[model samples]
Target chain A: AQRVTQPEKLLSVFKGAPVELKCNYSYSGSPELFWYVQYSRQRLQLLLRHISRESIKGFTADLNKGETSFHLKKPFAQEEDSAMYYCALKGGTSGSRLTFGEGTQLTVNP
Target chain B: EPEVTQTPSHQVTQMGQEVILRCVPISNHLYFYWYRQILGQKVEFLVSFYNNEISEKSEIFDDQFSVERPDGSNFTLKIRSTKLEDSAMYFCASSVGQGGGYGYTFGSGTRLTVV
Candidate 1:
């Protein structure tokens, strides 16, 4: 079975401080990783995907195959960065379903 | 930006009652999905539909659940008999391609409350 793990349920950081949200996955085959964010009273939206290798809203996540991790990182956290972040994994081939993590609720204090 | 739209922002029903949630996917998208999040839990995939039929479904989607695209513009999820544990926020999403490589557009969600 495929599973995604986000160890931290809640994370708090100060504005301008560096923040990191860790994500790990267990899948036998090649997997595609993605980060999704849900702000309060808003729908979940895509923050970034490992395949694009692009940064969104100053956040970047590198998929570490050796460690089986995809941790999202940002050099400077802003108040608006606070939200619920989820890690998701999709099988590299033949599947459209996504396995999601429990999610981390981030709080950025100004 | 195009978006998936779900109706009945909130619904409260008694246990064992049936309920149907509605969704309208982006006009050009080819794949549609239904997901649910229980209070303080992770979002779980329920099913995926394409070409007017179900393409994939998770174990959580048991016999009590069913999906249909009655027309070109709408997709619907029916829960034959809702239990108290079935209360959750149901979200609808659509993607232009398979595996969500192009990113999925999600609707605001319908909050279902089974009493």
Candidate 2:
């Protein structure tokens, strides 16, 4: 079974400080990872994907095969960045269903 | 910037009653999916649909649950008998294809409350 684990349920940081949301997965095959963000009263939106290797809103995540991790990181946290972040894995032989982590609440204090 | 849309932002139903959650995926997308998140739990996959058939479904999607693409664009999830545990935020998503690099676009989700 494919599983995703997000260790932190809540993370707090002051504005301009670096932020890292840890994520680990257990999957036999190569898996695609993604980070989804949900702001207050907004729909869940895709923040970044491992395959794209692109940064959005200054956020980036590197897929580490050896460690089986795809940690989302940002150089500096902004007050507006406060939101709930969910790490998801999409890879299984049968269908392209996503397995999501419990999610981490990030609060960037000004 | 196309997006997935779901109807009935909030639905309050009595236990054992039937409920239908509707969604309209991106116009050009080919794959569709349904997911649910309990108040404080992780998002879980319920079912996936493609080519007018069920591609996959999780254990939580039992006989009481069914999905249908009645029209060319509308996707609906029907629960025969709603249970208290069925109350959650149901999200609908879609993607171009399984192999595409694009991530699934999720709708705002329908909050179902069973009393």
Candidate 3:
């Protein structure tokens, strides 16, 4: 079975410090990975995807095929960056669905 | 700049009653999905609809759950005989296609409370 794992349920960081949220996945075939974020009282929104290879709100994630990981990172954490982040894998076959990780809560303290 | 919209941000229901959570996906999007998250839990996929049919569904989406695009603009999830366990935040999402770099757009979600 395909699964996504977000190792940390909660992570705290001081402002200006670097931040890393680890995500790992288990799947037999090639995978499409994504990072989605939900802020307090806000709807869930897409942050970034492996295929896009783009950065959003100063956060970037690199897809590591060999390691089967797509970890989200930021060079400097900001107080407003506090949010819940979920790692998701697009079920590969046709008419597929998205399998999501437990999610990690990132809190950047001022 | 289109976004998915869901009605009735919160709902209170009696167990065993039917409930419908409605959503209007992005106008041009072809793929629609329903997901739910129990308080403090990870979001779970319930069903995916495309071409006016259910393309995929999760194990949790039992016979009690059904989905339909009753009109050109509205997609709905109907739960028959709602259970207390069904209380959760239900979200609606849509995407351009099954495969794309662009991710799905999610609605604000409806919080269902069953007593």
Candidate 4:
């Protein structure tokens, strides 16, 4: 079974401090990882996909094949960044479905 | 930006009552999916539809649950008998294909409360 694990259920960071949300996945092969964020009352939106290797809203995640991890990081957290962050894995041969982790509630304090 | 729209943002029903959650995926999307999340829990995939048929479903998707794309654009999920444990936020998602690059776009979700 393919599964995603987010060790931290909640994280608190100061407005200007660096933020890191740890995510680890269990897979038999190379996996396509993604970071999705949900604001207080918004839909779960795609923050970034590992394939693109791009940053979104100052957050970037690197896919580590050996470690089977993709951690979301931000250099300077913002108040608006306070949201529920989910780490997902796209597995199976077709890779259509996404298996999500428990999610980390990031709170950026002023 | 194109968006996946869901109806009845919140619903409350009694146990054993039937409930239907509606959604309208993006116009050009070819694949549709239903997912639910219990309060304080991770999102769980229920089923995926493509070409007007179910392509995949999870163990949680039992006989009581059914999905239909009745009018080509409108997708619906029906629960034969609602249970108290059924209270959760149900999200509808769509995608172009079964590929990781084209990640699914999710709707705002319908929060269902079965008492």
**What is the model-wide C-alpha lDDT for candidate 1?**
0.93
DockQ of 2: 0.79
Is candidate 1 or 4 superior in lDDT? 4
Pairs in clash, predicted candidate 2: none
* lDDT tens per residue, model 3, A1-110: 88999999999999999999999999888889999999998899999999989999999999998999999999999999999999999857634588899999999999
Model 1, span A1-110: residue lDDT tens: 88999999999999999999999999888889999999998999989999899999999999999999999999999999999999999886537888899999999999
- Residues B1-115, candidate 1, lDDT per residue (tens digit)? 7788899999999999999999999999999999999998899999999998899999899999999998898999999999999999999998888853567888999999999
TM-score of each: 0.97, 0.98, 0.98, 0.97
Global lDDT scores for all candidate models: 0.93, 0.95, 0.94, 0.94
Fnat value of model 1: 0.64
Query: Which lDDT tens digits does candidate 3 get at residues B1-115?
Result: 7889998899999999999999999999999999999998889999999999999899999999999999989999999999999999999999998886658999999999999
lDDT tens readout by residue for model 4, A1-110: 79999999999999999999999999896678889999999999989999899989999999988899999999999999999999999885634678999999999999
Could you give the DockQ of candidate 4? 0.72
Name the lDDT of candidate 2.
0.95
Q: Which candidate should be chosen as best, given DockQ against the real structure?
A: 3
Error of 2 at A67 (Å): 0.9
Q: Give the residue spans of candidate 2 off by over 4 A.
A: none
Lowest lDDT 10-residue stretch of candidate 3 chain A: A90-99
